[model samples]
Target: MSAEFDVRYTAQLARLSLTDAEAAKFQSQLSQVLVYVEKLKQVDVSGVEPTAHSSEMNNVFRADEPRDWFTSKQALSNAPRQANDLFVVTKVIE
Candidate 1:
């Protein structure tokens, strides 16, 4: 990538105000990172399968069962404001 393009892209993404010197430095750093990623592309993985996570996992969900729920009074007891057995919140905008 060109230095000018890299600087513009970084500034746009990060909302940064970089000087020419800082842009030059960042461009060099980004170039190095891209080179490292390119090197990774050269590794052989023809038989390897893609995995979402590194660890082996099994579904651990418990069987759904009916349970007692809190009463309305108990549920709203600690609320700052309640109306008609429901919690009330401030309006966000006019």
Candidate 2:
């Protein structure tokens, strides 16, 4: 596709308003990117595995385990209002 066509089509897709000079600028940049993509397509990758990222990754989160936490009385100690060991707030739904 022509760079002009690509620029105009992309701007339309993104709901962008571009002046003539801005469109021309983007057309040039888009052409360069397309050229680089074409160059990348020529590289040999028969032995390389496809991956989502370039580096090894492992889960960084801690394992889920049971732990002691605040009791009902301690949790409700700072409540502005409470009834029967439960928080009291304005009813949201009619």
Alpha-carbon runs more than 4 Å astray in model 1: 1-5, 58-94
| Candidate 2 structure quality by residue, lDDT tens digits, 1-94 | 3444578778989999799999889889878887777777778998998898766986678879989999999999999999999999999999
Tens digit of lDDT per residue, candidate 1, span 50-79?
A: 898878996778879988999999999999
Backbone clash count, each prediction separately: 0, 0
The 10 consecutive residues of candidate 2 with the worst lDDT sum are 1-10
Q: What are the models' TM-scores?
A: 0.42, 0.45
Taking all chains together, the TM-score of candidate 2 against the true structure is 0.45
Q: Score each candidate by Cα lDDT.
A: 0.80, 0.84
> For candidate 1, which ten residues in a row score worst on lDDT?
1-10
